[model samples]
Target: MFFTDSRLHFFRPLVGKYREVVVECVRLLYQKLYTDLTGYGQSHGRDFVIDVFVEAIARAPLLDEEVGAPEGRFKDARALAGFILNNLLDNGWMERRLDEATLQSHYGFTRMGRGFAQPFVESGKLEYRSRNRNTRNTRNSLQAFAEKGEVYDLLDALEYSERIISDFADTIAELEERRLQLVREVESRQLIEQAADQFFDFIDTVFKPDLEVRLSADSVEKYRDQIASLIRQVRRRRKYGEGEHAELLWQTVMEMRLRKLLPGRVVEGQSLLENIVHTIEERLQSACDIMLPALRRALNSFTARADIIIRQLSYLHRQADEPLLDACSRLREMSPDNQEQALQRMGQVLAGVRSGWPASEQFVLRSRNRRRTVRATLANAPGLDRDAQKAQFISQVLDQAFHVSSQHIRAYVSDKLITQGRVYSKHLAVQDARQLLALAHVVSLAGERLDNGFEILIHPARSDSAGLQVFEASNCGDGYFDSRENFELELVDRQRAS
Candidate 1:
């Protein structure tokens, strides 16, 4: 009783600073003196502070070795409380060395026994939490007290504290922006350029073609100049500072390279670049002063829009030769007239621009002619080549996924229903239909409902079939298809259909 009385008397003086803090601490200490005893110090938000003494006891060996002390002896809540309680009652704890950090952190058992003591939250005390923006909970409450002629210390504190904190936040944000600029100059640009160069190199390695080399020296230089210039401009923007909107646009260009739109293969590289550059040139030329509605959103500003278009072109450049070559293969599927029309349309987009500038008056004449070349190339040739290309694409992803080859195994999947560890149908040497179905099944079982990236699954053979059962699946969650993420073999199916 004397101990409780002394503690309460000690708390009374603290009310001068705050009544709530005094009430909360006293309530908690009282609970520790009574029920819900645990050895863990101040744990579950209940128990006496005496638990801290369990450490020294745990270290001393017992005289009688028969006591089978459990592992992590001080870890027990009951032992913790027992040790602390014993120390407070048997030892002179009041004279022990102490510090502020220890005192501020110590907890006595309060009503809530969940590792946190419940300090009394008074009726008009300041609540520092973000349940909702405390817009109405502000010194707005002080308006009533203002009319009552009450002391305004709380209101003044809240008002000044808010301004000081908010200003500090803004100042920190400005510093962060400066830091990003410095990072761009010294670090971020190098990473972006390295990424871009990697993408282009990959394209050159896999898809380099004889036809691109066959182009006249003048043609080669012209295309080279355009590509090099674009790359340089992008690197500069990343290295130096550009407007946020412009930098973001440049970032999109970088993303295309990362995405393999500016692929790492040589065979498809050149033709893809030409196709993209020519298409954009044709669209923009056609629009003239008329806002070229189609290309306007794409090429509006030089920094952001143009950089994005260039990045996309770079992607196509990386994959050019294969698509064009495959385009030739699918020409047989088209009518003789349509085939001729496609080549002629392509010739035009590739025409007019001898050097840096495109040709005069007739260049973009109208909407039909503006996008005509792109439309013709894609509608006729790509439709056909896409068939075989889809197959090759599948081969690439599968090679990357399973670390295997589709070179000799054209018809890869069997029509087997996959068991738990299932093999699939696309593995057959048959046509693209089997490949397409097989690829779809392979991309599906990746348990992709949560993650938003491509997943590769290998389904084991169904039932008792002997052939190798390998299927590739990519889960397209939320019912969205990724055009670029497509496997090359599916392009074969598309060509056959068109």
Candidate 2:
């Protein structure tokens, strides 16, 4: 179908033996005639186009046989340029028109010709970084649709999502192509400099500017949740909202003829809005689930191959310069018997080498002295005092006898609450020092996993005498449990727990 078009006949010149001349001519024509701020500025007259073609043909290198032989049929740049220009005009690559005011013919490229020539012109220039903003544009478009509730905004989001997918796919393919090209170069030429240059060129032009940005700030995962939320909100409102919203959505769909954009026949009952939303959702899902992983793998594979090549090159480069490394490489390449012989020879060459303290130098050594021991007799031991022994017994009893724990506190509270449904801190009966200690620990243990079937509520105690009940207890002296806060213990109903 593509070859059936008559306009594509211009491709013949590009594939012919004199393609170099034709390519150069097209590049010059684009640069001179169309590279203007206001795209393809006013067309130039026939003489000007001829001059551009002549310059390109003169600069281009052609085979001596093609230029000087009988079949060439051209002897000078002017004649060759004229023939090429006529071929282009007749083949639909260039157009000629007469201006009424000037009464002369003007020349310019046709639309298809200009489109095809764009890549050639760009490839000749240096591209430092990618200028794509599809990821950011997709996010902004969806956000706009969410805020404005406009059908056009949703359409823009869908378009941007598709563009991002295409861009990622192109990036992956280009990376793989570059990797294969680099591998071929390394295999054919085995030149480290050229390979390193191309590798860094890729990093500067592609990896850092495009892939790195996509993996970080421009990543789909970064904006996936927000985009998904907005998409759902828009779909819900457009699909199920009241009459006014639905009418407006349908009007937009009809006006834009969005139904025609669907790939296949619409289902029996599906609506335009649903189809668009589904398509957009599918594109985003493919990007996240398929494209991202493929991109990561492609990048990792390229880098790993480049790394291995560069490391191998570097090692070879070192082997060529360093004697020791060269020897090791030679030894590795030799047979087992030869390798053993070489190593033995190397050992014999270095067998007498020794550098440390000289044998003539001597130093004296000192001996260590033994430690003295002393023994005590039973007759010299002093008798134990009864007072000290009694004081020690009291100290041990005070330290170990009155230690209270959470179980003890729980038991005390349970005993107090046994007579009633609840009890307050003021009513707690402290019978001895142990009960006083247990009461002190109840507040600390309240927040822990006591597993006690009760809850503690702490509140400020009232200043009235009835609220400030006192408890009498004794350790080795008189003591009272006083506090400004009161705690209430209520039984946890086991019926609800069950």
By TM-score, the best candidate is 2
Ten contiguous residues minimizing lDDT sum, candidate 2: 469-478
Alpha-carbon deviation at 346 in model 1, angstroms? 21
- Please list the residue runs of candidate 1 whose C-alpha ends up more than 4 Å from where it truly belongs after superposition: 1-139, 152-186, 189-353, 356-498
470-493 per-residue lDDT for model 2 (tens digits): 344432233563333466665555
Model 2 error, position 369 (Å) = 57
Pairs with backbone N, CA or C atoms under 3 Å apart (clashes), candidate 2? none
User: Residue 374: error of model 1 in Å?
Assistant: 58
* Displacement of the residue 469 alpha carbon in candidate 1, Å: 99
Please list the C-alpha lDDT of all candidates, in the order they appear: 0.37, 0.74
Question: Which residue segments of model 2 deviate by more than 4 Å?
Answer: 1-10, 36-43, 58-73, 129-132, 149-151, 188-190, 238-270, 324-498
Provide the RMSD of all predictions against the true structure, rounded to 1 decimal. 37.5, 21.8
Error of 1 at 66 (Å): 47
- In candidate 1 the C-alpha lDDT for residue 414 amounts to 20
